[model samples]
Target chain A: MLEVKNLTVSFGSHTVVNNVSFSLGEKQWLMIVGPNGAGKSTIVNAISQGVPYRGSVYFSGKDLAGLKPSELARKVGVLSQRRFVSYSFTVEEVVRLGRYAYSSSIFSGRSDDDEAKIEEALEVTGMKPFRGKSVLTLSGGELQRTFLAQVFAQDPRLLILDEPMNHLDLVYQKQMLELIRRWVGENGRAVISVMHDLNHAWAYGTDALLLDKGRVVAWGKTADVLTNENLQSVYSMDVYDWMRSLLSRWSR
Target chain B: MSKRPEGFKPVAYILFAAAMMTVMVLCICAGSVNIPVKDTFTAIWNTVFDLPMPEDIPWSIIILVRLPRVLCVALAGGALSLCGGAMQGLLRNPLADGYTLGVSSGAALGAVIAIAFGIYVPGFALAGTMAMAMLFAFLSLVFILSITYRLDCSLSTNTIILMGVIFTMFANSIMSLIVVFAGERIRSIMFWTMGSFAGSNYVNAIVVFAALLVFGTAILLYSRELNAFAIGEDNARHVGVNVRKVKLVVLISVSALISVCVSISGTVGFVGLVIPHMVRMLAGPNHKRLLPASLFSGAVFLMLADLLGRTMLKPLEIPIGVVTSFIGSVVFVYIFYSSRKAK
Candidate 1:
């Protein structure tokens, strides 16, 4: 379980995220939806304690700020925006990085359990075949999936993913969402994802938090918060009118 | 494509260790006065085991003259290469080494000043040059860290490398000024800058060994953290590495280790820069394999280079620095070309 209270992030005089608050429980999936520059990713960063902010974030009833990074990492996994790496590493090796928190010492090799988890994560992401391949040679979508496998191997109780679907194809998109859903459904873990796709959020999210200009616009069930009026106001699009026009065009 | 299999690492390490042992024996045997390999082995075994000394062997030449120099060469090489591997991982730059970062220049400046001013510490067991070199090496490390910190972009290789370049320029200018006024001490200063193990004794070799054990073991403990850092600082943090603490500890300890190395054997070039890259090329980028591999390869490479320097012209000993730098530049160019081709 995770809780955020009046989280605010600012740079100099410009506030990126305002006093917004929300609570997420185990087995719940919260999708943050907003337009560009709407503080959506900032909220994820704030809650994950990756960036400096005012207010408090609690994980399992303890203040997130008080926990050491290695300690917090055991409970929460984070996947930020995609970035490039300078060195060449095998896909299996990159995924093994996720087990860093579990590794007892540098002198010891990975335990049998860690290897099993790595294999399972690779299998879950359909990356088992590429275990011996270099990450430098992977395509964007493949690299994205490789990192996803890494986060999965972390096996954290709370997963905070910022734009996890950025480079994924439609098939992988489906697979990823299904895997995340199962993580919550079967394992009772929690997931908070920042998403740009309203349709995906509506179909997959149990709860939705809409943010615009650093303020929370709405927070509730996905269906309740994704009404035509709310979509029109927040996204500046007449959803119903546009849908009708698109439907007419398709009929023609 | 994937690299050579991970199994290649242990094999490579064993080969390198064997090469290091062979080079050590050859270095002890092939000095100005040639002692047969058999005599060299007997002298070394008898001295190490403290058995009755061999009456027919040149015990003084083998033990006092050559063995200490060989040990110093190997230790300095290992220390430099380990520092290089750590810095490259820390800076996320494959080319990073003490010379590039001006840390070695700082130590050289300290040594030159000590020699020029005749500043000697009576109580210290090691040479005054070693003590002053350690002092100035620490100072240079502190200075570099301060500038990088003040720039507030420690993660950016461009900023760090640029600051290093500027620091090197500043230090070199001071060194030039010292050379201009150094008059009678110019030869000594030049020899020190060019690096050598000619005057090394068993005591200093032990000191270098102790430094390698302490600092090298500590760096090995941080191999996991270094692997994470090589990816990116933020990525390292995500993987539960305390990035700041790891960087600080590695930088300080490595600088101290290099300073101790420079103190005993002067500032050997390319052993740090080239050996790590060679190890990585052979064993891949994982620090667990790369660290120890670099250590063995470095020791072997430097001992060979030192042997070449001594025997190339016979009695006209070339500075070890010159040989390594020459080889290092060729390797640097080759790496640059290959990396570009990779792109």
Candidate 2:
């Protein structure tokens, strides 16, 4: 389980994520939805230890206040909105990097178990076809999947993805979401993803958190929190009716 | 696409052989005095194979003076360019080179002090000067790295470049003041600053060769770490790279290499800055390929530059620094134009 308590993040004098709190049990998925600059991404970043925050985040009964990046990486896998690669590394090489946290000794060679995990990750993301290809040569959608394969190789207890579907097409979007859902179901892991598409959040997410201007406006089960009133208020658009129709379609 | 070849071993061997041949021929053919290719080969073969010395040619000058100078040039050039290539990876900046981050300026100041003070203590003058250069280079690297650490932020390429520029300006100003105050040693200091292959003997050649071997091997061992760093520090850290530790190791290793080169050759410019970029143009930005390629190409490029410097002016003998800058600027301009066009 993962719990965030009174999380507050500020940039300079302005607050970006204000007094946000939430909890997620194993085998649960929480999708956060908000408009641009609404602090949804900031909250995700704060939870992933990408940014400093004022409050507490606990994972599996341990305080995550001062954990080193490597320690945090072992427990949580994060996929940020922007990923940059400056070298022409093969897809397999990049995925193998995910085993860094688990490698016991620095000088010792990578073991058979590491290769097995990497192969499993490649199989899960369906990136085995391009495993030997240079990541710099990959297309946008294919690159995203490659990164997903890396994240899967991490085998973390908590998965945090910020805009995982940003550049993906509809087919890849479905493929990635289905993979995430299946992984969580089988491993009983916790996932928190920030998404812009309301239909996608409603379709795969078990719970929803709505943020507005860095404040959580509503948080609960997906169906309870994603009301017409809340959606209209948060988005500042008369999209409640459309959202309701979409929700019905998602249920079917 | 067609099935990729099983391995790159054949291409690697071909490149290695080609580079070796080019370096050997260029080394022999270059110098102020025009020794025939046949004579050069005979001299080399006689020395190595312990055969009878040829009577017509002066074997002493070729073996003692010219051979060591050429070897030093090749080794130093290869080491500097390889360091520059590794720096670009370590710093994640395409423009990074051996002299970036103020290492060359620090070395120059060390050399300037050594000459101006006339710090000659019997047989220890050269050793003392080289030690001073290494010390200054290491100190400046530590200062930059400490500042980077204190900031607790990734050292951005822009920040490091700016820091290097500031240090370079400061060192140059101090050097200028020393030059003004002490005019007697001006000739010696100027010679050191302008850079040359003169007076390079077997000792300096051996030192540079050994240093290059050690530094190059150290860098190759960290190839994976360098590749991770290329992706940015946050990602590298997430991938379990000890970013700070790796940065310190690379900084120290490259600083040592640059200091040793500067001690012997006195800041042969442009080879460090341009050769790595040229190598990257041929081989993509993969460090595994780029690092070794840069080393070989840098050696060849500097040998060619030295040859041009030696032969172009004939008896006058233009400085190697001058030739390198002239060639490098043209290449830089071409790169700039082509990159802009591609964009």
Each candidate's chain A: what TM-score? 0.93, 0.94
Question: For residue A236, what is the lDDT in candidate 1?
Answer: 95
Model 1 over residues B1-343: C-alpha lDDT tens digits?
Answer: 3233333456666787788888899999997788999998888898889988878999999999889899999988888999999888877777788876778878877877787787777877356877787788878977886788688755455566567668867776787688779777644655656788998898888888988888899898888789888877767877777777898889877877888887776678767889999888777788878888888888888899999999999989999999999998798678767766766
* Residue-level error in angstroms, candidate 2, position B241: 1.7
Q: Clashes in model 1: which pairs? A: none
Which number leads on DockQ?
1
- Candidate 1: regions farther than 4 A off: A107-109, A227-252, B1-16, B46-59, B110-122, B125-159, B179-187, B340-343
Question: For residues B224-338, could you state the per-residue lDDT of candidate 2 as single tens digits?
Answer: 7787777666667766677778887888788878888888887776676698787777776667677887887888888888877778777888888888878766865675465
DockQ values per model: 0.50, 0.38
Cα DockQ of the candidate 1 complex? 0.50
